[model samples]
Target chain A: MSSKISNALRWIGFTSLEPLLKLIRGEEPKKNGLLVFKKLLVPILSVFIFLGVCNAGAKYLYNIERERKIENTRSVQGEEAAQQMADCIDSGDISCKPNSLPSPADVWSGAKTLVEDHKMITADKKEFKEKTAAINKKRKKQGKSPIEYTGRPSFVDQIITSLKTVFAGFLLAALIAIPAGIVLGLSETLRSGLNWVIQIFKPVSPVVWLLLVSMVIKTILANADMDKSFVISFISVGLCSMWATLVNTSMGVSSVDKDYLNVSKVLRLGVLSNVFKVVLPASVPLIFTGLRITLSVAWMVLIAIELLAQSPGLGSFVWEEFQNGSSDSNAKIIVAMFVIGGIGFLLDRIMMFVQKMVSFDSKA
Target chain B: MESVIEKKTMLECKDIKKAYPTPKGDFVVLEDFQLQVKEEEFISIIGHSGCGKSTLLTMVAGLNDITAGDILLDGTAIAGAGPDRAVVFQSPSLFPWMTALDNVLLGVKQVFPHATKKQREDICKYYLNKVGLGDAFHKKANDLSQGMKQRVGIARAFALKPKVLLLDEPFGMLDSMTRVELQDVLIDVWSKEKITAIMVTHDVDEAIFLSDRVIMMTGGPYAKVGDIAHIGLERPRERHAVLEHPDFYKYRQHLLTFLDH
Candidate 1:
């Protein structure tokens, strides 16, 4: 219940902050309300009018294209189904009952069957209309269409799930990365040794890691007589992604000032409190830098892993659409690409926001 | 001033000697350097460029070992660097990540471990304000100018409430005006805190201005305190007027001739 007030306060804070920010930016306030609207009128109206016209134009074109495709598909399937049913009746095949009408599966099969029958084709308006009418009647009564059972996740659902996974995984990685980086960064031997490991693995391709892990998981499952491919993929990709975080953490630790170390010694601050208060605050800039780099790496790797392994992620959604070879697939792929790029851009921006928040007061 | 005058002698260094092992045999910086500081005495050691005045101060601060004799604080020999003897180093040795208040609090909290959190905070703020850095207390040490940073360092050292405050050319890098201002501030704080302070510098006027007794060391290989001038100038002495005093100029010229050797 308190969340309601908090949300209201948050909204108010933002609303009130707008004018203050405008003041800081030195924007002059309108003496009369009409002047504000007058200043905004041209750009706002032009943008809305352009958007409205584009949206209307797009909707009209889409409706026309959809109607054409729907007409084409219905006629094509209806003629094929009718021809097959007639042939079956002539042959006294009782299972091919044309009077009862065909299922979508049967209609689809019939379309393939009647692909060779060329006489009752397009340009024959009466035949096409009659066929479409039969298909529509069948669809209304029979409760099925002649579309296939495509095993693809819906684009919107895929987006939500992928976003959830990325955030959860990135958070987990960060939680693990900070402490681990501190430990590695503080120890000289660990820093050097780990740096060597990073040098070897950081630049190696994510696709290569995905392929190797997939093959390894396949071999392991075959040997164990168990199928646990998901766990293996996550482990492989997680490790590949964690490298940036680990290296960055170590770097942060290594770069703490000599005077701070002396201060800690002189003050006799206990290790736990010292690490939390002094070391952590001092190393934040580098830590966030690492997190940013690692986050991007993890995202890129997750997509590559999903695409290569056919895992249930955004990558798989895009791949499945491209593989389907439908006329709509190219447009869907374009939409999916935009969605992927937007999500990545948003993730990096979030990291940048966090960096700003953490490092803001450090300057004085 | 009453408290400082009434304070007892807290530390004394007796006939201390320090030598470094070199290929050409032992090179001595100071030999039989005897200094007995009463409680709250403002003492300055001035000498030639490499006369090991800093080395002498460090040994007394327990940062370095004395070869011959020992340093005693209230009749006990100093073993190592401790809270009772805080040193303000030449360089601004503040933790860059910590704010001025936090840097001061580092020493306060450590020395008075049983003090309440609010008490420590107040103490830190009080000392920082005493050093005229009340406004810059929240600023990070690194962001401060060199003079301001040194003030923070001085605040940190004095917050320890040390029996012996050792300074190794604390204002060496500052400009003349800043150096004079800090010297006055140092004098004011010393008069108030009454902590026994031993500052090492090459500035002749600084020694005459600040110290109760100015110990001038001769040039090293084996330098010793060649002359000890008792600066009998009155309290609240003006620098220009004091320089024109017959006795002040006499002491300065005597030290200049002695240092020429």
Candidate 2:
């Protein structure tokens, strides 16, 4: 039972828990206790200390700003001006207002409000569907299209949309890069021929890629009435992120053990079987490493692409809040920052799980 | 000896030459190398390092292109590596990802695609058991010891049922005990199958114990066979008996003399 728990923890990326579980089972508790202290207890204590420091620092800054505002009012006018400054500060109407860095409590409240807003939008969507059902039935009977909901997308909807776009872009990149990488890996002449082109395009920025993609897509999709921003953003993401996978895959393929190649030759395996059985399997670990890097790059570039294209995503949300400059906008932006970071971390873990699945090397 | 020569000629290397282009100019490694083997004869090529014995074996396996001349198997010129010629490299060279059974099965299935999966698996299991790797059939190559890995390599090569077997210092990496154990296993399999075999080695004792005829090569820059010593020991020779044989020292001295020059 203890071994089972250890294995489960290892599989879930919580290998630090194994020592604790072992200690619970009374299997070398002293050693495991030391491991637990180092891996778990110390880190937890450090996080608490950090949060405490942040809390105290934020309060100290808030008091200093309030005192400064009151002193400035006293110097400019008389007791009336000072009293008004104190009142404005108490009411949270100082000039600095909500533009200051948000405290942890503010971010917490901001996340709560976003969740509530998501729930309200979901309820509104349900109501809209019910109301449109009757009209849609009549319109369908008359061979007319039903009306679509044109309300602003909620925060949750934008997160889902961004995820969908990144996946589409990543899939496109893999589709093009993996096969091209294999071919370049197999043929020396081809690799040399295309090396310059790859080198030139690999370092191009995501913003530049977006501009070029938009210009080309605009010309090609001139008459098509579609979500041009969505298409443009995803294509740009794919272009900017594909280089890592391509370069890594080629290197992996080229460096496959020469003996394995001899084994294939001695067995007289056909070209296609040789690739699938030998080349692909041998290079899978490196290829997956490449894929992980590509996914992270895609996520990093996605926000810039979305902001420039004005697409509906967390990037646009942050940009919009920055422009809005209201009392709560700073807190909301902080919340979005945490959400984006959390999603990036989750994407990386998912890729690691996939890498483990495809590779035979247990060390990975 | 007369009866042995009466048997059919199985393989031949005629006027073989190999050279590499270095910055210094043409660096010749082997020149005018030639040999012939009768059917089912076990021939071991013994030489010091840089003697081009491995280059000769690789040419027969069709892995390396000869700069001049040709190699023939069963009266037909061979070109390029194929299932007809299987090689066991010095290192095990088994795919680290595959199990011992699966490594052998890969060769069996590839060479005999017309056979059913069960038949191919049985062939693989049979060879694996013959090499004393029955218990390690499911173990990955990486998990196996150096000796066990080489056994799997032998199983893989033998499973293909190739017309000719090539061994490039197959037991060079093992300790002495494992080396003797594997050499016995190899002899048992070779005696049962009677396939034409060529092994290149630097071990003088190994060459004498395993081969019907030991060919000693001169040192490089362009090395050639300096002498061929025939072992007339009877069939089913035991390792201890071969070591104690009267003619053993004579053949050893002849090989040592040729190598020293």
Candidate 3:
């Protein structure tokens, strides 16, 4: 049972805890202690060191900006105004503090504010729903749409929106890339013919894709009732991130072992059967690698596309916070930054897990 | 000897030539290659490296284009690769993602299209067990060792029930001891199916042990049949008994001498 738990912990990539678990079970304390130091204590020390550096840096930058403001006040106005400015800056006033880089505590408080704001909004939304429930039921019976709250979204809502947009773009890329990659892999002629197009489009900037998508999407979806900015953001994200999957899939498909192909030929398998049963299964490892890269790329580009396209997601949230330029706004931006990074990491782990589930070769 | 009723010809390779155009001119690998395989006859082609033995087998299997003449299977001209001819390659060709049973069932399904699902599975299970892989049916091909993978490959080919079985150095990658074990397993299975078989090999002892006739080929720019030694050893060949047979050394000497040139 201990061996099984150790194996599970290693598989889960929580190897540090394996030694700790062993220590808890009172098996080999000295060796496990050394492992615990190497794995757990060292990483914890590094994190504290990082926070310490951030605290010092934020303090240094704030002091420099505050001194510059005080100097400017003395030069422009008088010593009295300069002393008054110093007093204001020292009073922990939000209006006068330099919002250069947020301290760790500032970020913590910013996250707290966002959570409380989300709670307030939830209460308001629930009250609005209760007030409209009877009218909505009547409207439903009459085949009319129910009323929706038009209030602002919270930080968590923006994260959920970003996730939705990223998933949509990722799905679009897979749907387009996998089939196109299979076709390209199957035929040398098609691969060569389309090679230039892939090479040219693969490295195009997400901001540029957003510009292009906007022009085309507006023209195409002008009469449609759907969200135009959402469509543009997701389409641009898809176009920006699909290249990795396309290239990897084609390479994987074309490089299938000759012996496997011989088996297919000898079996007289139909084209579809040959592709799905032989080609796809053989190429799955490469295909999933491409997909993992595509998902991560999709996420990285989504923020830029959302910022440009005015989509209501983390990208737009960060953009708004930057422009709002409140004393607390920089801390909020930092929070969003960490949230974006955390979500990207989670997305990659999810893709890796899915890849492990599908591929058979243990070495992969 | 006369009571060995004359078996009818099942496969005929007549004037088949394979040529590849190089920078200078056409390089002929094999020209005017001719042979006839009697029904249920096991024929092994023995040659040195680059002697076009594999070329002839692949041509007969309809994988390579016959540049000059025709290959007739039971009177019909062979066109392309089909289930009527199953090949066991030197490398394990089982799909790495599929289990051993699934790999065998892949070929069984293609050949027995009208067979019930249960019957197809039964065929796969039966062949896998015949290859002594009864415990490893659920293991993926990538998980199997080189020798075990070859066992799955042999199981897959036999499950097809093909009219002609082409063995291209099938035991070339196995260790000597595993080679002998798989050879015995092969002979045991062949005695039951007894399809027309053609194998290309570098081992003289393997040729003598398994094949009824061993055909030696000349070295190439244009390789051809140099000599044919008929093995009159009795049915249900045992390895130890075949090794101890007096005429076995004679056939082995004949093949080795031809390959030495």
Candidate 4:
């Protein structure tokens, strides 16, 4: 049972848990305890340390801004104006509050508020759906469309939307890049012919891709009944992020071992079979390396694309909070920042796990 | 009855040459090579390194382009690599991601495309078992040892049921112990299948031990057949018996003398 758990942990690329499993198995408790401290507890302690530093930093900045504001009021107006500003700041009035980095507690409170807001919005949506169900049923009987939910998306809703967009973009990227990469890999002439194009386009920013996609998509979808922003955002994300997978795939395919190709040849394998059996399997390690990079790049660039396209995702959510500039807005943005980073880390770990599973000889 | 009917020519290399263009001029590896391999022949080409023995074998396998002349298999000019001619390279070259069975099955599937799935699987399992990999059938090629990988390589080649088997020093990378062991495995399979084979080797003992005819090549800059020694050992030759044969030293002396030149 212990060995089985260890294997499972290793398979999922979670070696950090192995030490704890060993501890549970009652072998080398001191060694395992030390490992647990280094692996799990140290990282946890570091996170607390980081939060403490952030709390101190936020307080220092807040006081600095408050003092600057009061000094400015005294210089521009009078002593009375400065004292009034100080009182308003202490009272936590929005207009007089210092716009500074939010402490950990503020971010926590911001997360709670978003969750509460999501719950209330979900209830409202449920009520709306229930209220409109009968009328929609009548409308459907008369060959009419049912009522659609057009309410403002909550933070959680925005996160889901972001995930959907990133996935769509990733799929589009893999679809376009893999075939193109294979073609490029197969023919040296084609690879050299298109090298310049790949090189020039690879580092182009997501913002530019978003603009380019928007221009073409808007014109094409002008008369079409489609979510133009969503289409544009995803297309831009795919284009902006596909280069890593493209380059890696081509490199991988081209670098397939000559000996494996000999095996393919001796088998009298057709081109498709040769590629599927020999070339692709040999190239998969590098291709997955490329794909992992592609996914991370897609996730990284998606926010910019979403923001530029005005798509309903985290980008838009953060943009709205920034524009609102309320006392809690800084806290909300901090929450969104951590959420984005945490999601990106999770996505990378998932891809790493997948890469490990399909590797040539895992646990060999 | 004509004796020509009994002794059919399975492969012919007519004035074959291999050369590469270099900064100074053409660097010729082999030139004016002429040979005929009778059906079911076990021929070993042995020489010092860089004598283009491997180049010749690859040309027969249709992997390398013939810059001059042509190679014919069964009266048809061999084109690009085909299942009719199977090759076991210097290294196993088994697809690392696949199981040993799958590696063998890959070729079996291609060669016997019309065969039933069960038949093809049976063919793979049979060969893998022959190579003593019955227990390691499901083991990934990457996890297999050097000897085991070469065993799979041997299994894969034999499983194709090729008219001709080209072994480019199939056991060249193995340790001496594994090499000798695989030598027996190879000969046993080769003799059982009754397929004509041509092997390139620098190991003189291996050449003598495995071949009906050991064709020695002169050192390079356009190497050709330097000498040939026929091992007149008895059928289904055992290693100990062949090694102890009175004429074994004579044949061994003859090969070493040619290599020395």
* Regions more than 4 Å wrong, model 4: A91-95, A358-364, B1-6
Candidate 2 deviation (Cα RMSD): 2.5
Collision count for each candidate, in order: 1, 0, 0, 0
* TM-score of every candidate: 0.63, 0.93, 0.95, 0.94
| Tens digits of lDDT, candidate 2, A13-38 | 88987887888888898899999999
- What are the iRMS values of all candidates? 3.3, 1.1, 0.8, 0.8
- Locate the minimum summed-lDDT window of 10 residues in model 2 chain B: B1-10
- After best superposition, candidate 2 residue A127: deviation in angstroms? 2.8
Candidates 1 and 4: which is better by DockQ? 4
DockQ of 2: 0.75
Candidate 3 per-residue C-alpha lDDT over B73-126 given as tens digits, one digit per residue, 9 for 90 to 100: 999999899889989999988898898999999888888889999999999999
* Candidate DockQ scores, in order: 0.22, 0.75, 0.79, 0.84
- Candidate 2 residues B1-261, lDDT tens each? 457447788899899899989999988989998899988899999888888999898888878889998899989999799878889999898888889998898889888899999999999999999999889889988899999999999988888998889999999999999999999999999889988999999999889889999998888878887989998888787899999998999988888888888
Error of 4 at A76 (Å): 3.0
Could you tell which candidate, 2 or 3, scores higher by TM-score?
A: 3
**Ranking of predictions according to lDDT:** 3, 4, 2, 1
Collision pairs in model 4: none
Residue range B1-261, candidate 4, lDDT tens digits: 223557789999999999988999999999988888989989999999988999899888988998899899999998898889899999889899999989899888888889999999999999988988889989988898999999999998899899999999887888999999999998888778889999999898898888889998889979988888988776698899988998888999999998888
Question: Looking at candidate 1, what is the lDDT of residue B33?
Answer: 75
lDDT of 1 at A198: 70
